[model samples]
Target chain A: MNIPMPDFMPALPEMFLLGMTCVILLLDLFLTERSRVVTYLLAQSTLLGALLLTIMLYDNSRTLTFSDTFVLDPMGSVLKGAIYIATFFVFLYSKGYLRARNMFKGEFYILGLFGVLGMNVLVSAHSLITVYLGLELLSLSMYAMVALQRDSVVASEAAMKYFVLGAMASAMLLYGMSMLYGMTGSLDLTHINQVTAAVGSGQQVVLAFALVFIIVGVAFKLGAVPFHMWLPDVYHGAPTAVTLYLSTAPKLAAFAMMMRLLVDGLGGLHAEWQGILVLLAVASLALGNLVAIAQSNIKRMLAYSAISHIGFLLLGVLSGTAAGYAASMFYAITYVVMTLGGFGMVVLMSRAGFEADRIEDFKGLNERSPWFAFMMLILMFSMTGVPPLLGFWAKLAVIEALLGAGGLTWLAVVAVIFSVVGAFYYLRVVKTMYFDKADAGAAAIESTLELRVMLSANGLAVLALGIYPGTLMALCATALSH
Target chain B: MSFEQILFYVFSAITVLAAGMVITVRNPVHAAMFLVLTFFSSAALWMLLEAEFLAIVLVLVYVGAVMVLFLFVVMMLDLNTTLLREGFARYLPLGILVAVLIAVIMGLAVGQNHFGLAQVAAPAPHAASYSNTQQLGELLYTTYVYPFEIAAVILLVAIVAAIALTLRRRPNTKHQRVDQQVATRREDRVRLVSMTAEERK
Candidate 1:
């Protein structure tokens, strides 16, 4: 009853971005086709302004606002900054593609901004209700974005599938949450943690059931195995630009959701949840790696690759240690960087009539453009977890975390074996680019200079980070420690 | 049994029967009507539990708005009931398995033994003058105002998404462009006659 008026400063970035998104939505309506640039510029500046505000409002100590529904802390600030940077690059890459297809409109930018806002709220959520609302907003925006190219029946079908499955998963999550609420008498994560820590094993049956449903929901969101039927279809069916955006930043939000519900909220149930996560991780690793080798479509292959990467991400969180959490964060950030580049290349080579989504499309890419091919090589190698690449270090961090868990040595071994299997498909992409003969009159790269520069930077940055992982690893450690 | 207990049993039985009919009815409109009945009976049952606000809201929202929308869509679509029922037999085994599993789980967690009157004392009824709605409103607006605002934003998003998805510019339909009309210039509409009149081919 005596909760003071909560300080609004912790929420300024979200508020600022929300207001600017609305202003741009209105401002775009009045602008002519020739002046569509204004809308794009406004959207870009909104992200920049939000990033600036996030840094300005950054606090070393954790702050809870909105009556303890929202949290602003080092982890949230870091993740928000990553989302902004990733979205900034995604928007820049999407422009030329949209313009070429006559799909350049304000809706894409507006929906993307809303999606970012959803991710922002999700990463900082301190309550079950906040997490649910944030997840819905993000999922809705993504569904709309997937169906943005209205003339494509494939896109529409994919959107329908994604929406239906996503809704069902969310309902399961809510059902589990209701059970937890009944048990704990609170929806606040901190309060739930406190209540759960004191509960006896007599409630184990109900708790185990709740954990299963919650894990199912989280696995579905992360595109882990058995719950990942929608991923390949949605990824392959959406516009490559939308796919690029969807695959990159949303992973961070899902990671935050897992951290909140599993770590912050229900740490007392770690034994049960961790067992479920291990099963999901192994299943995802096996199915993802094995199925990816058979896929001829590049998007579907990457979708499977994403599934396998999620398995690695889970290895860290399943460890249930601070070191593991920090490693998982590092893996998520690096995965986003690598995915942006890999999908960016797919977007770059695609033109008005060409989708450039087949494995053979990259044949002899080196002969066409050696520099771009090398950039892709860096991305592919990093994804394969080859030594001296960013992905290698990401995997190593999680493996070490698992080893430190002491009892999960078998899981660590399984992860390493699957990573080796995963390497084959990634290497095949590189082989297709360098050794295979070029098709007659293969389309030339006609992307804008901005996209080209950004894509190259995105790819090379993985290499740069691989060489200097110390700073970023330490940053993750610091963020998770607080 | 007392009159209140007898009424409770009657309403709950009706609610269960209607809910069963909602899935089993052959006609789509009939199914929707059964759903409305189910909602009404459930609302009555909530009233028995002294949750007047929940009862009224359930009736007003579910029976009034949501069921009407469902009926509208069901009527608008020309669905073939025989074709819809074609896969029912094929999937019956799987469906039954799932149903049985869910029943067992629910039984273990919230069956009569866990939720019976013996386990939970009945809440004392409030005076007739007391208002459940006012208490609900006070808590919603004060303690849960953040979620209320978030719900508003979600509704706004639904509106924007609906319009964005369905609204389209049809090329077959012709409409005047106000921008072109307003930006009209003399040269754009009609050229000067100084040297153009004699140049007809």
Candidate 2:
């Protein structure tokens, strides 16, 4: 069969990023140490260009390319835009920290760009092959990024754990995909959807079995409970810069993976996966919140907080409605914004010899710089779901979505109760920053002006969005409406 | 039985028996040998399916290259097989129980058409002119080219990651710097020694 060439217009951003990444990879090798800043500039500019292309290509209609192996739709566009923005900020946040730590190498930026490309591919994935490839690309880059600080044993351990578990998860996910292919006789998600919709009753059990493995992959990627064992260790072990990137952009890829695999491809079997997600959401919410309270390290604390946030995100997903999907997208974006500022604070406070990972490191932070203290305050409050902040609206939207999905009132109540329980840790961070006396040996915030400016905007954006979330909310709803 | 049916049974029985021996063998070397047999028999089974390209690649890759490496490693290592087998007897019951459970489940599933297994029916035979390899190649190049390229990128990332994680410049190492070697004039590595030569004389 002779296949027609796919339209390059929809894949413009990805092709551009892929080509620019190659160019940047070569350019970095030729540049001197002092001129490394140019590489950073080029990387950021590449992301900006991709974002511009994605925005230009935004449309109401879905466009499939590469023999339906890739897709361009409103949801993909929105997610791409978010990933680009998050990754752009991530590069900025990491620059100072990476420079101070003597890891200001081009590889960080290159792997980061690769990771970004992976996210774009994942968001635009139209088939099982692309989904698996995109996820592996994202994961391999992250594993390398985790181990980028080659001399740190902790970083190496984290990287190893992540690599082994991530590789296994990918294998299991592939197994599930193979099973789906065997049953449906197709790899393209659209064709698979058609096949599944008309599948005989006898095959439903086998399909359900395959769905379990796929759900495991999704849960593991999302860092939901039980499968979330790697999240905290990886977060705590990695350099704050890598952690910031890990905590932000790649999440959109996971969310997109869930949306593609579950809603688009397996919508016919919603009843099978819904119960699984519900269990994952509840377990994540209960355990994540309760465990976070006993944590002293802020990175691990945020890790647990991320798990609970995944709970809310999954709640939005398991509702099995358009509104819930939109709500999940909103929650995912909100979680990214909060984490960018949260981990950004850690990066800002860290100096060459000091790692501001411990919660006690924030003692007397208010006295050190009241402005940043307020930024931290806003971030923590937003995360705790306090009113008039982004996290509150995100949680409310998800809870409303859960309630709207009939017969799920109890899950909503569980989410709210955990939110209340989760508030204590966020409050403790604030109280430590404000009430505690400045320790004589406290590390000073080693922030450059750009970081300080971006960090402030990052925090204020959360509050601003919290105050007026309608526009963003509408964007999410409209993205999924098609 | 028909000749084709006899070949299928023969290959499958050898495959399963060798796979079982691969785990049960006391010596690592024997285990490795059994693994090679398993691979060979599995290839035969693939051949029965008319997947000639896959079967040949499996034999060449796994049996030819990988199993050789495995044998080399097994021969080189000074392994304490007795120590390794110390816990095997203790765990045998639990292992057998779990294996039986899985076998039963698979047996039940395969008995029906749920798995599309050999027990239910055979796939339709292809004509002598049909070629699986050619069809697969055409589909890969034409339709699955995007994923194929992505897979290539994944390999590139793996190479980059390996270098990034493991490759380091040891400041004290005596490795030659090609740039310094080529850029060497007279003064960098030599010293004028006329007075020292007279003193030695």
Candidate 3:
């Protein structure tokens, strides 16, 4: 199947990202450590630049480039835009944290730009091999990032676990792809879909197994239950800046991969995969929320909370409709905002030589800094799905999609129950901040101008979105319109 | 019965043997080395399948770059073989059980009558033009373009995530900023004076 390259420019966002990354790398080399602010500004500007390019390229028309392996469409554009914006904020949030840690290096900005580039590719990939390439690129960089704090045993251990588990998932994904290739004689997802659509019900059993193996890879990436053992440890062990980036950006990209592969590539096999996803959704909700209540470390708690949100996102996938896809995308976007704010608070509360990761670290936060505490209150409430918060709208969209899908009443109920359980933990953070007494020895919250500005925006955005979610929802719907 | 089949059997045996040694080798460094051997043989098998690009990449990236890093880390760590082996006896029965279960399931799943062991297809007369590498390249760059671009973006995000995780500031450490060092010139600290000795006095 020879596809003539479209006359349209190939990979506009990719070209922009590569060009920006090089410029950032070269420019950072000349910036003094005292002027590390320049690197931060350059990195943020690069992400913003990429985001603008993505928005400008958001046409509904689909074009295949590099001959057919790369695609440009509204869906990919919106996802790329979200990833770039999320990355921009992560860069902003990390600046002060990195500066305080004495490990501020140009490699951080250069590598971050590359990582964002990889995610853009993963979200737009339409072939199995391309998917693997994107996944491996993302995984390899993450492994190195997790181990960046070489002096910390916890970080090293987290990296090791991540590497081993990630490798196993990659192998499973590869084996599944090979099997699919052997059966269909093609690596193109469209071809695979056609082949599977023609197969008999009995033969579909083999396809089902292949799908299970593929979902194992997806489950690992999403940190869904039964494959989520690594999330809490990695989240707790990584430095706050990395944790902020990890919790926000990867979730969105992983959802993009899922939508491309499971929804678009294998939509015909929805019956088989939906069953598996329902089970996973229920399990993730139960395990993630239930386990989180016991965590003393705020990062670990949020990690579990992330797992449960994956469950909510999976509900949208189980719906198996365009609306469901839109809802899932919205859920991912909202979750990114919530996570950034959640981790942004962690960054603000932390000081040099001390990581403020424990739930206890926030005790008396309201008394020590009322404004920051109020900001955290809004974020926590948003995460808990309280009405009039962005998180609430995100949850409402998914639940409505699930209800509309029908035949999933039990799963919907489980989702609600888990939301309650998850809320308990988020609320616990609020209680620690407002109800409890402040610790006399608690570290003073860092008052870097950038941190303050970003944190305020990150937290306020949740409220703003919650109140006027129509715009985000409209964009999501447009992207998933197909 | 043909030479291709003979070569397949040879590489298959080497792959399995090296893979077994990867687990059995007591030293972590040796185990990693054996794993590298396993990867090389696997890549050779991929070449036999006519996937030249994948074969070379598997060898170069996984076997070369990845495994070299693995070896470097394994050698640097102070590993205790005895401590690692202490739980082997306790876990051996469970491991064996799981392994056997996997073997049985795989045997049933891919039995000759199930998945069917069809003979490999004969290569087309124009094998040179229909080379796996060329075909794959054409397909990836053409029909699968969106996915290819998306993959690149994911990789970029991963790079960013890595940098963010490792970059930190420590109050106790003193580090030179590149810009500051570059700003210094020969004339800034070392002034050329007509009578340097008299000036010093």
Local accuracy of candidate 2 as per-residue lDDT tens digits, B1-201: 999989999999999999999988888999999999999999999999899999999999999999999999999999998888798889999999998986675565444667655423668989999988998898788888899888988888888888888788789978878998999999988997675335544
Model 1, span A185-295: residue lDDT tens = 798999999988887676666666777778888889999989999999999999999999899999999999999999999999898888889998999999999999999
For each of the candidates, give the backbone clash count.
0, 0, 56
Give candidate 2's error at residue B45 in angstroms: 2.6
Q: Please give me the DockQ of candidate 2 compared with the native complex.
A: 0.61
Runs with alpha carbons beyond 4 Å of true place in candidate 1 = A1-4, B1-8, B112-124, B174-201
For all predicted structures, in order, the TM-scores are 0.93, 0.92, 0.86
| TM-score, chain B, predicted structure 3 | 0.80
Candidate 1 reaches a DockQ of 0.35
Q: CA shift at A451, candidate 2, in angstroms? A: 0.7
True contacts kept of 3: 0.41
Candidate 1: interface RMSD equals: 2.2
User: What ranges in model 3 sit over 4 Å off?
Assistant: A1-10, B2-7, B27-79, B111-201
Question: Candidate 2: RMSD over Cα atoms?
Answer: 3.7
Q: TM-score of each model's B chain? A: 0.80, 0.73, 0.80
Candidate with best lDDT:
2
Candidate 2 chain B: worst-modelled 10 consecutive residues by lDDT: B111-120
Give me the displacement of residue B184 in model 2, in angstroms. 11
